[model samples]
Structure formats: C-alpha cells, structure tokens
Target: MQQNNEIPQFDLAEQIMAEQRKNASVRRKGPAKRVGAPNQKRKVEPLGHTIKPQPALPEQEQIIAEIVARDIKKLCKGNARSPRTSGF
Candidate 1:
C-alpha cells in the first residue's frame, strides 16, 4: 500500500496582516464643528508702570527677618564644622 502526503495550504502570518488592514480602513472620523475666537483679550501693562506691589505688615516682616537669620546661622555652622575622618 502507498500513502500520499500533501502540505497544508494555509499561512497564519499573512491572514493576521490582512485582518489588521481591513480593521484600519473601517474607522470613521467624527463631525467637524465651528470654532470662534476668544471673547476678551488680556490687558497689557506698560513697560515701567507694571503691577503695584503691596507692603508687608510690620509683624510679618519681623518674622520673615528672624527666619532668614536662622538660615544664615545654620549655613555658617555647617561650614565651620570639621570632617570626622582625615584622608591621605
């Protein structure tokens, strides 16, 4: 008895790529709408006459000065410290 053997006629990779192309072409874009300009424009300040600055309260100014003094003391103390280990 003789038996005949034939290879299957199917390609998995080609079928997958064809399916992807079919899906991409079926996409529909949404409807377009009309757009209008902004209702109000921003105010432009003059070169030298910019925004006016508000003065800080006396109590607030004293607190801010004390905080700044503390920060300076911390920086000076850190710089005056000696290294724990000496290197060659």
Candidate 2:
C-alpha cells in the first residue's frame, strides 16, 4: 500500500482559506428589514424634503397628467430612458 500527500494538502488549503477570510473585508448596505409599506410609505426624502402626503388635486389634474405621460412616452420612443422608467 502507498500513502498519499492529500491530507497535508487539504490542511494547507484550509489554513490558506482561514487566513484569507480573516483578512478580507466586505461592504454591507441597506436596511436590515423593511421599514414600511411600499405604497403607503414614502422613501427617505432627499435633503430639505420631508416625508409628506401627496397633495390633493382637482379631478382635472389626473386627466392632464395621464395625457402628458402619454405624450412623453411618444416623445421618448427612441431616447435613452429616464431612471424612473428603466428602474436602474
């Protein structure tokens, strides 16, 4: 029967991995948990803006907004998309 070098190789590999992990750094991000309901809560506001209710508008504004959105879609047919529509 013949012995093998595999055991020492395995030990060395484990030691290298442990050392690397000890020296490595990682960046963490975002909230640890959901803060609030997506639709009901506003995202954290930028500087100078506070979380506030969207204003109440006359019924006419809704229709005008829709019409403008459609015109924007038409005008944007070939342009680079804004972040709002591309989602990143």
lDDT values, one for every candidate: 0.79, 0.70
Q: Estimated TM-score per prediction?
A: 0.46, 0.24
Q: Write one digit per residue (lDDT tens) for candidate 2, span 1-88.
A: 9888675435878898887876673333347743655677667867986789787677778888999999898767735655456523
What stretches of model 2 exceed 4 Å from their correct place? 1-57, 78-88
Worst 10 residues of 2 by lDDT: 25-34
Global lDDT of model 1: 0.79
Q: Return the top candidate by TM-score.
A: 1
Residue pairs of candidate 1 with colliding backbone atoms:
none
Clashing pairs for model 2 are: none
Query: TM-score of the candidate numbered 1?
Result: 0.46
Stretches of candidate 1 above 4 Å error?
A: 1-7, 26-54, 82-88
